[model samples]
Structure formats: C-alpha cells, structure tokens
Target: MPNRTDLEALPDIPMDDDGPVFREPWEAQAFAMTLELHQQGRFSWPEWARYLHQEIDKAKQSGDPDLGDTYYQHWLAALENICVDKKITSGEALAERKEAWDRAARSTPHGEPIELDRAIRRGEFDK
Candidate 1:
C-alpha cells in the first residue's frame, strides 16, 4: 500500500479519472503490480501509496528521467510493459469473461445481468 503523504505529493495521473500517476518507469511497473494486487485484494490504498513513494524516491535517487514528468508517460509505458510482462490475463481473457457474463445474463429471466433495461421497460421507476 502507498502512504497518504506521498500519494498527495505525487502528481495526478489521468487513466480513467483522477488518481496517482507513476513518476518513474519502474514506479509504473510497481503501479501495475499494485493494480493487479488490488484486483486480487492484496494491498490497500495506504500501502499502495507508500509503495509508490518508495519507488519514486528510488527513481529520483537513481537519477533516471525515463519515468517522465508529472504525467509520466514513461510511467504509463512501464505499467503497460509490466502488465504484458506479468501476463496474468490477456484482453482475450477479458473478452471471454464478458462472453460468459453475457451467457449467464441471457439465462436470467430478468432480461439483463444488471436488470437496468428490464426495470426501465417495466416502468418500475415511474412515480
């Protein structure tokens, strides 16, 4: 997990919305691992931030500008690189997951997995 202080200090990273941006290339790699670990329910936010700060400081001390600026394009590159390196799941895997979800959804009599469309059609929300 990352520290609160370091996380606040780090620049804003825009992936989907507002979040931490990896400052160093290796930092990005760590971020990717952290994300995977998060998905797997390993490290919490505090621990992740602390880890990120430790990594960024290491990059600064090492004097490697490859991590890039506040945006840290290199960081993003590193994340992608590491994600590929780890290869726990591929895009195809996600597609398969989605396909399975769809099948399960169609099996349900509610119409959709979320039931949003069915609810709307039923006018359950109408007042």
Candidate 2:
C-alpha cells in the first residue's frame, strides 16, 4: 500500500484532507487497482511515477489542456502501459477488454451497473 507521502507525490490527484477524493466509482477502482498492483510488487513507486509522468506528458502533447479532470485517465493509461511493458498483459488484450466494457456500458440500462460477464453471456462479447 502507498503511504501518505507516496500518494502525495502523485501530481494533481484530487485529494482532500482525509485522502484521495474520487468523483466517480471507476476512478476509485482505478486507484485501488494501481495500489493493489504496487502492493503485489509488480512495480516500484518510482516506476509508477515515471510511467504516470510519461502518460501525462503524452496527453499534454496531444493537447489535453491539463484541466485536471483527465488525471485519472492518464493514471489508467500509465497502469496499462506498465502492465504491457511488464508482460502482465498485452496491448491487444487491453483493447479487447476495453471494447468489451464499452459494449457492456452501451447495452446496460441507465442507472444500472454495467457488467462484462452479463454482456458476454448476452452475446455482447464473444466468449
């Protein structure tokens, strides 16, 4: 688990006095995923920081505007990049999973949870 100092080292993390503040459930999930991967010794804090910085830099280069709302997007991208680089998962697998989630979200009713398994079972994604 990341300590206070480690979390604080992240750039523009939407934190309050208590800790990191997430405006959406997916953001919290992404944060938790990163922490869990770190705890598993998949990557060091410095490696995570470097990947995150690279993602942010790439987004800025593409004219992201640095509005802070996209911080977690960069964080998620960094996580994916690190996972791919570490051979934990391939880019193609990530893209497929992302497409599956998109299909699930599109098929789900408003205010209902989007579930990939449900979508798959419903033929939204091939098993």
lDDT of each: 0.50, 0.87
For 38-121, candidate 1 gives per-residue lDDT tens digits of: 567554555544444555556667776633453353344334333444574455544555565575567678753443344433
TM-score of model 2 vs. true structure: 0.82
Candidate 1: residue 18 lDDT (0-100):
54
TM-score of each: 0.32, 0.82
What pairs collide in candidate 1?
1-47, 1-48, 2-46, 2-47, 2-48, 2-49, 2-50, 3-49, 3-50
Error of 2 at 104 (Å): 3.5
**Candidate 2 Cα outliers beyond 4 Å, as residue runs:** 108-114, 117-127
lDDT agreement of model 2 with the native = 0.87
lDDT of 2 at 44: 94
Alpha-carbon RMSD, each predicted model: 13.0, 3.0
